[model samples]
Target: MWDRIEPLMPADPVRGRRWADHRRTLGAIAWKYRTNSPWRDLPEELGSFQTAHKRLIRWAVDGTWEKIFAAVLAAADALDDIDWTVSVDSTVVRAHQHAAGALKRGPKAEASRLTTHSDAPAVG
Candidate 1:
């Protein structure tokens, strides 16, 4: 997988401070998402959490992530390892009647609002 993705990453600038190792940054990213944890919680051994987060955002904005995903999918397809079929059951998509724009108050409540206080019995 690394072999397939490494070529897609942006090359480090030749005349400035080198960027974090792509492989290490990627491991941090995978670990962060796999554990559903905050970026700050990333382990020190994996490299800086900020690096992983920044790389993720940068790649997303520049379309590098999309290129990597396409490369992976293409590889999987070539190996006959991907199933493109999609199935969704209609029963699983149900919504409540109120969600269909029903009245906020029912007919009984509406009628109650129309009643006049003068119609009530007098108290001694």
Candidate 2:
């Protein structure tokens, strides 16, 4: 699956041998996202935390992940892997006080204004 991604990656420098499997690199990324931990806190067995982080940042800049996801969805649609009959639900998440950080000594940041078009609900 990652064969397509290999060519996209830059040629590795000073290649002796890759110490980590691609899955291990992916696991490190998942762990980082799931726990919202700093990359520096990643487990050593998962490989260099900075390497996994740098990969994500590079992909983000290139929009590679977005393209990969879209391609996967297209393939699934072609193979009838998508269950179009599935139910749908709208879920709203409310932010709690914990989401707000402790106060710091600084001027209040200006909030961006929300605008709505004629087809959208009116904003008061």
Candidate 3:
């Protein structure tokens, strides 16, 4: 996977400072997402959390992520690994009654309802 992604990485233009190792940075990113942990809590051995986070953001902003995803999907399709047919079961699906243009409560009514509580206040 790393081999596949390495070629898709954007080249650093006018390189002043060398970028962090891609493998370690990618590992940090994967770990963060896999554990649903904060970037600041990323493991030290995987390199700086900021670097991983920055790389993710940069790739997303520059459309590199989308390109990589498309490339991967294309590769999978070429290898005949993708099942193009999609199946939908209508019996298991549901639609809310409100979908039929039901009237929605106004902001004032909603606000009052949220602020109004039945529980009595606690006494010291």
Number of the top candidate by lDDT?
A: 1
Would you give me the overall lDDT of model 1?
A: 0.88
RMSD for each of the candidates = 8.6, 11.0, 12.1
Q: Could you tell me every candidate's TM-score relative to the true structure? A: 0.69, 0.49, 0.64
TM-score attained by model 1: 0.69
lDDT of 1 by residue, 1-124 (tens): 9999999999997998999999999899899989999999999999988889988999899999999999999999899999888897777676797797554576775765655679786443
Any runs in candidate 1 off by more than 4 Å, and if so which? 85-124
lDDT-best of 1 and 3 = 1
RMSD of 2: 11.0
Candidates sorted by lDDT, descending order? 1, 3, 2
Better of 1 and 2 by TM-score: 1
Error of 1 at 45 (Å): 0.7
Residue pairs with backbone overlap in model 1 = none
